[model samples]
Target: MSVQDSAETAVLVSEWRDLLARHAATACALDRELSERFGLCMSDFEVLERLAEAAEALRVQELAEKVHLSQSALSRLIGRLEKAGLVQRAMCEADRRGIYVTLSAAGDERYQAARPLHREVLARSLAGHRPAGG
Candidate 1:
């Protein structure tokens, strides 16, 4: 390849882009399958998975951190899930300003149903994928 062409290719395949590309690929696969089968998006599934692992209801801030979403975004997502009856939200008794989130039975069921597909998609999407020049 010409030097200019090589440099352009390298830039396109930089480590950060490679990482993001791989994530996008895997996320797309997971989203498609999860959405079709369970009516859940990837973020929705992530919220439920995190809530399922919690011993008790998680504070909104805590869940937001775990799910890597801003507090406002998480709140909006929570609102959607709450509307769909997949999750329940309550004001913390100890601190009125605090909000707690818990997975409802339906959320758990959906998460359980989708877990295998999630794993399968992850494996299939990532299989044979590697960083450029690895």
Candidate 2:
């Protein structure tokens, strides 16, 4: 309402944006660092994490949805993971156009290796934050 109040609001908004951007950078960096440490790309890690929770296997589209990736992007990531022996794709029995992506034994090992780093990064990122006013 007042000029001072408006200025404070703007500053707060800017600070929030800056914090978000920095957090994004930190997340990307953590992913890169972990990937380098484990020889697994970020996308590859994500795919493995997803499969690790799956009871059997996941459809390619389902994987894409969980990771918020486009079909082509998911396909490329899946291809890399498959080539790395981290995952395998098979034709879906019920749907000819659908593909099922499953984690290989090697993928499970890589995922186990990468999980700790993921948790560490997440904990470090959230360490300084608290409930809005608490």
Candidate with best TM-score:
1
Report the lDDT tens digits of candidate 1 across residue range 6-78: 9988987896797898899888888899999999889999999999999999999999999999999999999
For residue 132, model 1's alpha carbon misses the true position, in angstroms, by 16
Q: List the residue pairs that clash in candidate 2.
A: none
Clash count in backbone of candidate 2? 0
- TM-scores for all predictions: 0.85, 0.82
The list of candidate 1 runs beyond 4 A from truth reads 1-13, 129-134
The Cα error of candidate 2 at residue 120, in Å, is 1.0
| Alpha carbon lDDT of each predicted model | 0.92, 0.87
Candidate 2 CA-lDDT value: 0.87
Q: How far off is residue 69 in model 1, in Å?
A: 0.6
TM-score of 2: 0.82
Q: Write the per-residue lDDT of candidate 2 for residues 48-125, one digit (tens) a residue.
A: 999999998999999999988999999998998899899999998888999999999999999998899887876777
